[model samples]
Target: MTKNERLFISPLPRYAYWLFLLGILISILLGLLFYRQVSAMVQHQAEAELKRLSASTSDQFQVYLQQTEYGMNQAATEQYIQTAIEKRDAEVLNQLLYGWQQNRNHAELWAILDKDARIISTLRGSSDNHNPLSLNGLALRAMASANPIVSTEIINKEELARVGRNVSDRLENHHLLKQEGVLTQLVIVPVLGKNGQVLGALCGGLVLNDNQELLRSLFGNSQAMHAVYQDKQCIAYFTNDNKVSFPEQISPAMTKSCILDGQACLGQMQSDGDTYVTVSRYIFNAQNQVIGYQVLALPQSQYSQLPAWVANISLLTGFLLAIFSIIVIGNTSRIRQLFDRERQRGQESYYLGMFAQKLQECTDENEVYLLLKKYLSRDLDVIQMEFNIISADDNCMESIRFTENDQVSRVYLNQSKCKPVLTGRINIYNDDRDLHCNQIDTDLIKSHVCIPFLAGGKVAGVVGLGSPQEQYWTPGRIEYLDAYLNLIGPTVTNIRLLKLLQAKAFEDQLTGLKNRHFLDQYLLEQLAIAERYKTTLSLLMADIDRFKLVNDNFGHDAGDLVLKEVAAVIRAAVRESDLVARYGGEEFVLVLPNTSTDEAVSLAERCRQAVNSLQVIHNDYSRIISVTISIGVASYPRDGNSLEALYKLADSALYLAKNQGRNQVRTAQEYLATLQRTGCDD
Candidate 1:
């Protein structure tokens, strides 16, 4: 053959046959190994999922029982129930019961039993169970303990009829509602009179026959079914089909945990030829007491499939392996497509994870805003973006935009200006119906999309993105953008909430002045500055004259208005450098840095005159009330070294100003002069 010529060689048929057989053997061996590995992994994951389900089930029990008990206890304390019970008036009590019965979410029976265990219900309906409610049951326990009690009992047909409660009258749609016997929950909360005597018991009956609604809601799932047991007896059974009975029962160990111990249990069982990993726990009552047993049975789908496949591997070893090879070869391109798609999703998830980490480290919304600009801007080619966030105080909308210099520029706007915020949904602008958010400036960008994020069930902010391209927001980009918002939205909300809380903590609610706590921290800082720099810091202490009389005559509401008005006037007289605080009731304090006692006294005089000139309207009395204030001035490094000493001197001066005459100013020096004039004084 020439150097570039191709050579065609054919092998013998037996040689090809042996090689193919060897390939089949290798494929079969690999398949078994892979099956075992995957089965183990899936089994581990299933166990973990089972444990999680058990925890969720336990939480449901706690919440349900606690809510039921609390509701009954609150009902017992209702004024109507107490009054009717105290008066032995069945008509009024029945009226209340009738109203409660209308809400079918509540227990099957809502009635009141007298102290003698005699049914005092005015309800005309008969109980589904014929067996009478035991006198020594939940009601007796509630009355004897003088507290709410939750207990389970089996009632025969129409048992609650003795109390005038008709069981069949409620939600008769369920064929399973009527049974040979009914499992019922009796919640009893004792009603007490003014003297703390047990007047009656509020009895609630809950039917538990084939009731999957409770567990279904708790699990947020309807695909999987389970059972409830009271030892050997099944109280509730749920399955995919009503014709198929529950395939398992409570194990001996579960019985100990459920019945004897009234605690949770876990084990494995076989049901209808399928293996299940079961989680069992105690069902509780309103008193937070365990009364029954609940179970969660999840099929071991992974384990079940593994054994069957292991058997199939032997049945179709060589022939199936050859077909598998052919199938794998045929699906090579499709598998690659699947892998590429998964790789893209994985990349997106990695970026989102990093974004979430960065968002969590953010201390303020500005940092979060910066992160959005950094991460999302690159992915979406977003030329401009703005966050239309609602202020925590007034639902005020403020737009934050990034400029070319990377500086955050904020513009305040009305909350109603944004469509996404007002409508609580994402507003997409692609010339669709010629609709757009009024807040967006169309001149700045070619296309825009506004996405709203919710926190605490209300829209907290709208993230507006703009680009120089129309129809630019494709489905993929939109979905990715949603994920980005989900990560960053919570960070913005948390920062805003924290800021609101901090403002509320330091600022007074009524007067909008710095509270005592803030003043205390601020005073220490100012004092340190004065001492370190060897500068004078003057403190002005002022009091609203006859403030008590204002409250006593016009009521506290009017007094609040006077205080707010006075605070505003005082705040107007002081410079921004000066710190103003409400120092206890009707007393105001100002800390002025790098100032003389003379300047502080002058400012105090202005504050006093402003207050004297102001008139507050008490609308309730149709009165215009005139107010006056007394002021005293003290300076650091001149009057005293410490805050306490300066405050005492200022307080003494303020007392002197008030005694001398109302609506006047005094200094610590004046106080000393008066002490000398009086003589025999400290």
Candidate 2:
């Protein structure tokens, strides 16, 4: 409540009609006292009738003004309108204004006005000027305040010409216009920017003197004439007969009050020996001061028709309210439905965004397929996903599928059998009998979609999605599936390439065993574990006996074959926990964890015996080649507790084994005992 309402209304007013004079709760109790006062003026019923008509006419004017303001506000907030204004697109702006006028209302002259009141663009209406029109002062208040303005005033001849209406002389033929200036109503509604700045205003004008459209709608068949006044001076008059005289303007003073005090006025007037009743309504500008007034007159003889006219108005009002209520209720339900759809769309967008982010973190080809499987299952009741393994050497593709239970299955098919892969497009199958992919079962899925994904400029995988209802595969869902498939294909390819590069970096190309670099990394980890647990760890260094003679006689290719055979035999002889790597050419090293020196020596002999049974033929199988390996074993924490010490002791053991015989296994303890005995003999 306002301050005045609390002081005068809430404190002391329960049923006091005097509060009506204060305009408190006027929207609810408007015209209440005026209807009560009409009884006192029954003797002069023409005045009361005039008040009824004037009040009705003023209500219509308020409605029209409010509607124009609302329409302009809607235009101001339109996406296309705002874009056009921000871009200075005059052509699109003018077309939009024209369309709005055609669809909404055309009584007002419409123009898009800049901050300075100059025409930015306008719908081609009454004004036919080659140049733009500008409202000199009518729009100034609205633009400055960033609010709507509605006022009625006499526009001078010079201002009308600037606004592209130079028809002052043409109006000399009408008797009322010859003596009085034109009354024009200007409505200015400001357009706001994104940050609440006033970008411009929409200036709409209704030329009251130009036509009888406004007055005809209000008093077309009524026995009345409406005259406009500014500062009590006659300006314009409207009558169905189009023959109102200037003498009607001079015959009345305010009967109750002038509009300057924010009160309605009733006056008596005499023109041509006839008594007329007049009522005036206030017209305000931006500052809320009365700038003009409207005087509606009714002949005293026609006062008897007042009662029937009021009854008709009351009936029409009730019917309109009933229709408006239904429209409001229906619109409320529609708004809820629209909100639900928007919320669902937002959720789908969020999930797709997460899917894109997860794709970046996958480092293995199988991980990429699993990620794809997870995404499909999130939004579908039943889903199917598969990958095509392309073997370029065999020149064939194999379709592999992992079921929900994660059982792997493969089916071989021609590359051209799947439509998506053959045509590089999406295959949409909706029935069981349709030609579908070999990996995706059409019988299981009532609705299915499949698309091929590319890697290295070639089709690498085919993705399929299934749903029970056809509506689930909307255009948006289909597009998302295609986009994600294309996304995962590249990711899987990159992971496979990285795996291949890692294998090449750590594995020996000739012997197919982990290389020396790989051993160095694994040895540190095993040694740390041994030191923590106080367990035995041994290193065995082995050399092929007479390996140089084999390579020198049978070329380097035969040597590589022999080395590969011997490395395989050693790998088969050791435990799974042991690591064997190519130490160098003609030599191999094994790092055995949790093994004693004696256990390592036994493992080395088993490998040596396995190699003794192996034979490699070279040069068209004409010559047979046999080789033996001499193995040396050293235990950690028994040989100086360091990698260098272990390696030095192992090398000395291997030299002793070679000095004794080529095919044998020796421990560092045996070698040290022999060295001490020989020294004592010396």
Candidate 3:
């Protein structure tokens, strides 16, 4: 046989198969052994690197959390917050936060909340771009925690909302974790009062996205170590790396991770069987309170730079060489195609993740909704995209649609000649001449894709995506939108609930003097401090002497008028800090935290005189009526230590003043005889 034929043909028939199998077996064995060794080495090195990096990152995060806690605590305790709280001036708080947010290089946003957690002021990077960071779940959590609660996880926009807190709990909802190339960290600190109540929360963040310098600092910077601050405000350090110290800017994730994990994860590394490893720890305050967190990550490629598959192939070659011959298969082009699609999918996933992240960072639901519409319009190149907020009544959808020029239009189905895309239920279609279409009076959305916005398992609103011209819609685009709706729908519902709750809390259902509930809690706190400091604290109890007579004479309508009249008179009598709470029935309680008893009594008398001299015409019969109030004064420490006690003392005085003369001021001591005769606490 010629050389070519001989090479192509088998050299030895039976023996050749045996030898080949033996060789393959030998290669497989070698490969297995090599893979094990490589894996072990990579794991050890990766773990070491991750440990070092985690230590550095964690330390830095702790430092940043500490600084933020300090700053927020300092700010919350400042006269500014106090002044704003006293004055109920949200603008003052906003100005303060806006000033802080303007400071470049600081990853901090400041906000002040009244007791009700309303966004009084928010300071972000720019004034025009600033969004109100609504406090809903966060405020509830903050109020529940006694220490500076750290959130288990933080949404980006939420971080922008809550700028300062010492301890945190993860919000029940969390943003999807990004495990692609970009890394994120979120940290939250609660601004606490002296009584260990959460006045507000502070949030900070750090991103490890294309920031190579920060990554280099973790691996390359020698002075990097992990440190944490406890509730007692003491700093503690923990690290395996001897050479590394902390950085000024800490990632939020590290802080969040440490607080969540509970125990100190000194050198823990989790591998994804690929190139990266994550290490994390739980931080505790001096009071054994877990206030901070730290985490670090490292790339396996950092050590030796060997492909993981190399080790598997090497091990297989040594231990299971026979497997190599069997491994060679006939599928090539099909596998390559699958791999290409996967690669494209990865890229799409990355962009989608980034879009979602940015979406989560949006403080305005409308902005996010518009952004989604824009993405569907511009990114997907859809002809048009529309969103609607479903109204309570089934009349029409509140159209929240966006255009190419970023113009938003609301198409009311009832008012305009638009086709009813929805009557009472959710509807989606690609119709051109729908009545809702005419609702879009602008020429932009003549026709396009339309979807209904559902919330709380009901059709809350309708979303109409329109195109001036006819366009093709794809299943993938629809799928993307479905996902977007899934995220935004719940957020919108939550915001709506939040707004409703906020209105109920801040608004008065009746007389509107803040509220008795808010006043009793807030003023009692102020009074407590005044009492502690030996400062003057006063309370005035007033009762409209003849209020009941109005109810008897003019039916309940006239009685309601008198109550409103009394409320107006009371409001006109005192300054803002001096709260007037409707104690009960026709009586009102005035709390003056920094006023002397004499001043309080004088103020009460003014309200009394105002009510007495005021005339109300019952009818056209030309009959005029006037009412007077008996005033009671009680001073803190001199009267009683507690709110209830002061109220009782003042009420007793009021009763005595009423009995002695209908419209005169009386002190608690002056009413002591009456209290003894009545044998009642009042």
Candidate 4:
């Protein structure tokens, strides 16, 4: 051997080069095998956890479901719900719900949904355990699932319908009670009738960070087991009795896995530097329908130190290090470049992974927009970043621009060179324009890229990202964005669909006013607000004083027009806080919140006058028809404290108005007293 070679060689280990190469190959192969094994083990553990916890939670959910059915059965006979159903004691139901709120911690909220999913009553408080339940969130979810008709049929189905279906059980976390606070996780269980109908769901939750006992019971006493719910969906990680939390961001991988596989998912995927064993199960109702999913995960840190193949591979490779060293020395410059490229790739990959994770966690569409801006500014090392989402239905885009001095102004999305981005059709954007990057000295416009948020197979919105000059959009970045959209799009779509469904539920198609069902709900809400604020809530009952008039005289078409016109008058007469609805044919009800009986009477009188003075052109003829309305007024804690009582008093007063003289106002108490004192002896 040459002297120089001999000097470089280690005297004790001559077979080191061959052994090192062999070890490298073995290490990679063995490590992969170990990883797979660990993954399997983790999956097994996660499934076991899900089976155990899901069983427990499912049981709890069932109990609530039972309670709801029982309530429905009772309400069928009970005066409160029955009256509300028959529109006889509508105010009574509201009073009960208000009283029920006082003892909220006792149980979950139980509601009776009409064909529309509007809450009729909630025995328990909301997920936040404070605010009265509103259809804003739940209706969206209900609408997304089967249509409203399903409930009518379901209500009549047998208990057997609960069998063999994946019953949904999940937690809802939101800043409902404390504004600007961490999301609170609440458990929601649906109440399905024996006839395969959903009466309403029982919604209640364990206070986040409060019920450690229950948490440990479900997830085990593990620091890694943490549960969080977003928009009625949940994700949790468990380790022993302690729990760790998942960020409220969703990842592209998770999103894809969820949609492709279904909501309840369990898998071991690449994230950060370690592998985690995860188990996800979808929450379902008593009918075994999908609600949301629960995720149980274990970090690799827990089992990484175990005697696995990766450690063995490393141990075996050490003996062959010298052989690899010799080979590596022959190509030093190439190795350096390779290492640099890998490092760059690694950094980019890390950011992308984080971005994916956050994307999956987000529930609201707007959150996606905010995340894009943040990632471009922080992860991409951009000087200035701005983005806008073009509303497919409306012009919804934000803009920002940059000058030569790196001075950035938030330009609108409309001002950006959007043609290329629109052409790319990618859901994520970064600086992909070569010309823009080369020409711009400022960071804001240099690395501009845009991604569209698609819903229902169409571009519903766009997300744009940017960095400083000469930025190139790589396939990796595009892939990263595509991954994010894969997760975000469905969630956005679901939310949108949910809103549409809810809107359909409470709306009257012909008159475009709140329906009878909606009126009941609104009355309940107003009653509670009035009680809380100790203010008056006045109800005005007005019936179109006429000949069945428009319908009988001008046909049903003219009657429909009169109804529409009357609705418009009521809508205009009431403040936003007031509730207006078509109580029945030719009769309308207006609930004026925080209004006194005098105010309600005055409001009703105005409505009557408006109707009487209005001219209706039937059959394209300017036919001036004088229509009049009989008005009745009732106030809370005076006329009655209950919805039913108030309504009854109003109706009685309305009867008196009709009896004495049409288009006049009257009170139930006064008329009733007069009736008792002066009996017309025939």
1-682: candidate 1 lDDT, tens digit per residue: 7644544544468978889778777767776565666556555545455555555555445444454565456567655567666666777666566655543343566677766556666366322223335633666777878987766665555555455344555424554443444666666788887788888788876677656765454444333456776544565666665544553345664333232243556566666676666667766544565555677776555223344544375345755655544444444444446446645665665576667656656777788888888888767867768887787665588888888777989999888666677788777776534446665567756677889986644787888887777788887788888877765654555555445545665788889999988887898899999899988899999999999999999889889999999999999988999988999889999999999888888888888888889999888668999989998889998898888988999999999998988789999999989899989475
RMSD to native for every prediction?
A: 13.8, 28.0, 19.0, 16.9
- For model 2, how does the per-residue alpha-carbon lDDT over 266-372 read when each residue is reduced to its tens digit? 76676667776667787665456665677777665544322434333334443333343344345445544644554464455456556656766665666677777
TM values, all candidates = 0.54, 0.44, 0.37, 0.49
Off by over 4 Å in 4: 1-363, 368-378, 383-387, 395-445, 622-625, 679-682
**Judged by lDDT relative to the true structure, which candidate is superior, 2 or 3?**
2
All candidates in order of lDDT, best leading? 1, 2, 3, 4
Candidate 4: lDDT of 376? Answer: 56
lDDT measured at residue 573 in model 1 versus the true structure, 0 to 100: 87
Residue 16, model 1: Cα distance from true site in angstroms: 14
Model 4 / residue 301 / CA error / Å? 32
TM-score of 1: 0.54
